[model samples]
Target: MEHAAPQAWLLLALWLWPLLLMALAMRTQWRWLPALGALPALVSAALLPVGTQLSLPWLLLGTELELDSIGRVFVLFSALLWLIAGIFVATLMYREPIGSPSGSNHFAQRRFNALFLLAMSGQFWALVGVDLVSFYVGFAIMGLAAYGLILAYGDPAARRAGRLYLALTVAGEVALFAGLVSLAAHSGTLTPDPSLLAAAGGPSLALILLGLGVKAAIVPLHLWLPVTYTAAPIPATAVLSSAMIKVAVLGWLRWLPLGAVTWPHWALALSIIGLLSAFYALLIGLIQRDPKAVLAYSSISKMGFLLLLTGLMLGQPDLLGAGITAMLFYATHHALTKAGLFLGLGLYEQNTHQRRTQQLLLAGLIFLALALAAAPLTSGAAAKYLSKPLLQAAPWHWLSPLLWLMTLTTILLMARFLWLLRFPASKAGWEGTAAHPTESSAHFELNLLAPFLAWGLLLALIAALPWLFAPASFWPTNSANLLLALALCALVLILSKRGRNPLATLIGRIAPGDILGPLERSAQRLRTQAGRFQPGQRSTRSTESTRSTDPTSASETALELKLRGWPVAGALWLGLGMLLLLLLLAGAR
Candidate 1:
C-alpha cells in the first residue's frame, strides 16, 4: 500500500503526458516530439505491476484504469511500436526539415504530429480503461483522429481514403454507442462482468460486434484499410496497423462473456466468418500492386485468426485462459513484426541509391516477412504453436485443414508483398519516391543511424519473442507448415521460370478495395437516377412558364408553388404535431 500512490500517478501520466505533448506539438514542430510523447506510456508499462488500479469516481460517471496481464502486454508492445515509429519519423524530419522553403509543409507536419500524439493517447486510454464508457470514448477518439493522419498529404487519393475512413468510423461509433447504452441499461453497470454480459441481449452483442468489427477490419467492413494504408505516411500506417486495429480484439476480450456461457450457434457463425475473412483477404492481397495494401490485407487476415480464437472461447468456456494467452501473444508478435516491416520498407525506399544499404534493408524486410509468415523458430511460429491447443480442442474437425490452407495462403501473400517491393509504383506517393535522392555521406548521420537502431531493436525483439513464449521443443514441431509452404512457393517459381507463369495475368487485375469500386459506381448511378425526379428542374420550369398566361393554369400553378413554400409546410407540420399529441393523450388512459 505504501507504493500505491506513485504507481497511481504513473498510470495517470501514461495517457496524460501524451495529451499535454499533443498541445505542445501543435505550436512547435519538434522532431523528437513523437518519441518524447510515447515515453511515459512505455515507462508506465515497464514499471507498473499487473493489477494496478487507479480509479477516478469523479470523472465521467466513473472511470478506472488498470494494468492486467493482457493490458500490460498490449501497452508494452504498442508503446514500443509508437516509440520506434516516432524515432523513424523524427529522423526523416531531421534530415529533411519540415519548415524548409514552405510554411505549408511546416503546418502539415505540425498537424500530423499533433494528431499522432492524440491518437497515441487515445490508444493507451482504450487499452487501460476498464469501464465501457471510457473504452468507447478512447476507441472513438483514436478512430476519428486517425483520419487526419490518413489525410496528411491532402492529395486526391489521400482525400478519398480519408472520406471513406471517416464514414466508416462514424458508422462504427454510432453502433458502438447504441450497443453500449443497451448493454449498460441491461447490466446496470459500466464495468461489465460475466454476469452483466450474460444478462445482455443478442441485439447488444450484434451491435457491439458490428461496431468493433469495422475496426477489426472484418471482410465487408474492411474497405477502408487497403486504400488508407496505401495513402497514409509510413509511420502512420505502421501504428494504425499494429496498434489501432488490435484494440478491437482487446475490447472483445474485456466485454465478451467468453467463459461464462456457451452459444454454439454464435460460435459456429463467428468461426466461419473468421475463416472467410482470412481467405478473402488472402485472395485480394495476392493481387495487390502496392506493398502497403498487401500488408493491409495481411492485417485483416491476422485479425481473422484472433476472431477465430474468440469464437472458440465462446463455445468452449474451458479454453478461455489459454485462448486469451494465445491471442495476446499472437497480437504482440504480429504488431512488432509488421511495424518493423513497414519501417524497413520506408528505409529501403529512401536508401534505394545505395546498393549496400538496399541489401541490408531487403534482408531485414525478408527476416520480418518470414517471421510474419510463421517460419520455424521465429515469433510467428511460436504464436502458431501457442494456438495449437485451442485449435485442437475445438469440436470442429475441419479447422485443422483450414488452418493449414490459411498458412499456405499467408506464405504466398508475404511472397507477393516482398516481390512487389522490388518494383515500387513509379508515381510519387507516400513511400517518398518523389523526394530527392540522399547523398552517400548522409547514410551514417545521426538522423539515419537513429532510425536504423530503432528498427534493429524491433528486430531483436521479434527474434527473442519465440524463446520468451515457448519451449525449445515447440520450435522443432512447427517446421512442417514452413516446409510445405516453401515447397509450394518453389513449385510456383519454377513454373514461372519455364515460361508458363500462372500468376502473370493476375497481377494488378483486382484493385485495392476490391468491392468498393463496384459499390461506389452503383451509388453514383443511383444518385444520377434520383436526380431525374427532383422538382424545380429547367424542364419543369419551362413547362410551368408556358402555362402561366392562362388564368386557370396560373391559379393552379400559384397554388402548387404556395404549397411548396415554407409557410404552408409550417402549417402542415403543426397539424401533424397536434395529431400526434391527441393520439398520445387518448392512448395514455
Candidate 2:
C-alpha cells in the first residue's frame, strides 16, 4: 500500500509533545508526564503505519513521519526499550528515595524526566529524519543529552568516561558528515535512496564506514566503550547500549548504497574486520573485572558479527534481505539483554546481601547472554542459525571454519562475561570503594526478571514460528551450538575457583592503541618544531639580524621595477584600444 503524505506539524508535534510535556512538568512539578508522553509515540508508531505520511510545505523546515517495514522495526525496538527503561527509572525514583541509607544517591524525578524527554525527542527525530540535516540534528541532540545520564554523578571515573565518550562521539559525527556530503554530491539529490548507496564505491563508502565504525565500536575503533560502559550511570548506560548503538547500526543500514554494485575488496575487508573484532574484543573482554565493561566488549564483539553479516549480504541480495531481517531481530534481543544486565549490576551494588530472587535474575541474564551470543531458540540463536544458511550460499565456503571459530570465541567470551558477573557481585571483587554490599535490590530484580520472562517467551515463539513464515531449509546443521553454550556455562560453574585468584584490573595494564604514548610523542615533536620556527623569539631574531647585515646596494637593485614609467603604461593602454578598434573594423567589414 502507498503511504499518504503526513502533515509536517504532526511530525513536529511528535517531538513537540515531549518538549511541551517537559515544559509543563517543569512548571507543575509533575515528574511522570514525560514518561507518560513517551507512550503516545508508541501509539503513533502503531497507528501511523507505512501508508501514513505527511508533508508541510509552509514550514521553513519540512517534516515527515511514516512507517515502512524497516522503519517499523527500528521505531518499535527503540520505543519498547525506552518504555522499559522509563518504567525502571520510575520505580527507582519512587522506591530508592532521594538518598538511601547506603549513601548511593537517587535522582529527582524532574531532573531525570527532562533528560529522558530530551533523549526521546532526539530518538523520535532521528527516525523520522528523511533529510540529512534533520537526521544529524536528531543524532547530535541524542548524543549530548545522553552525556547527562553518563556523568550524572561527578565521580572521577564518570568524568574520565564522559571525556572519552565525547571525544569518540565527535570523531564519529565528523567522519559521518563527510560521507553524508559525498553521498549527496554523487546522488545529486537531497532525498536519499537507501539502495542507491550500493553504487557508492570509494571515499563515500570509507567515510560512512569509518564514521559508523567508530560508533559501532568496530574492533580498533572501539577504545571508549569499556570505560564508559563501566562508569556511566545505570539509566545512561542502558540507553547507550540499547538505543544509541542501534542508531549507528541503523545509519549504516540506511546510509550505505546496498543496492549498488558490490565491491569485493571492501566486502572481504569488512568481513575480516568483523571476524578480527569479534575475536579481539573477546580476548580483551575476558580479562576485565567490571561486569559492565565485559558487556561493553560483548556488545562490540556481537556487532562485529552483525557487520559481517551485513557485508556478506552484498553477494546475495535475496539472502541479504533475510540476513537483515534476522539482524534486526537480533539487535532487539541484544538491547533488552544488555540493558537488563546493566540494571542488574546497579541493583546488586545497592545492598550488601541480596535475599531477593537473584536466581531468576541470573537466569534472565543467561538467556540475554545467549540471545546476544546467538544461542538457539532465542532470537539471537535463530539469528545465528539463519546466518549460517545465508553464508553457505556465499562464495567463501572456506571461511565457515573461521566463522565457527568466531562463534566459539563468542561462547568463550560469554563464559568469561558470566564469570565477570559473579566476581563483581561477590565480596572478593574489585571495589572502587573498599566497602560495598555485594547484594542487589528487589526492585532491580523485578525490573530485570520481567524482561527475561518476556524474552524467554519470545524465544520459545521464535523456535516455533519459523514454520509459519519461512519454510525450513534442507541442511544437516552443526547441532553443537547449544551444547557448546551450555558446556561453557558448566565450565564457568565448575571453575568459579577463579574467585580466589587476584581479580583482573578494570583499567587496561596495556591500553590498546597506545593512545597516550602517541599523543605524547606527537606533542614533543610539535614543541621541537615550534622552537625552531619561533617567529619573534631568539631563532627569528638571529635570522632577521643575518638578513639585515646584507648590502643596501644589493637590496636597492633587487627592489627596482623594470617597467615603472607612465609612458609605457599609456602605450599599453593605447595598444589595448588599437586591438579593440581592429576587432570592431573587422566586424564592420
Best by lDDT: 1
Model 1 residue pairs with clashes:
none
State the local distance difference test value for candidate 2: 0.64
List where candidate 1 sits over 4 angstroms from the true fold.
Answer: 1-4, 93-104, 423-445, 538-589
Give Cα-based local distance difference scores for all models: 0.84, 0.64
Off by over 4 Å in 2: 1-12, 25-29, 58-61, 93-109, 198-201, 425-479, 485-589
lDDT of 1 at 534: 73
C-alpha lDDT of residue 495 in model 2: 44
Q: 63-106, model 2: which lDDT tens digit per residue?
A: 44545566666676677667656655655444443324453543
Clashes of 1: 0
- lDDT score, residue 566, model 2? 24
Instruction: Please state every model's RMSD to the true fold in angstroms.
Output: 8.8, 14.2
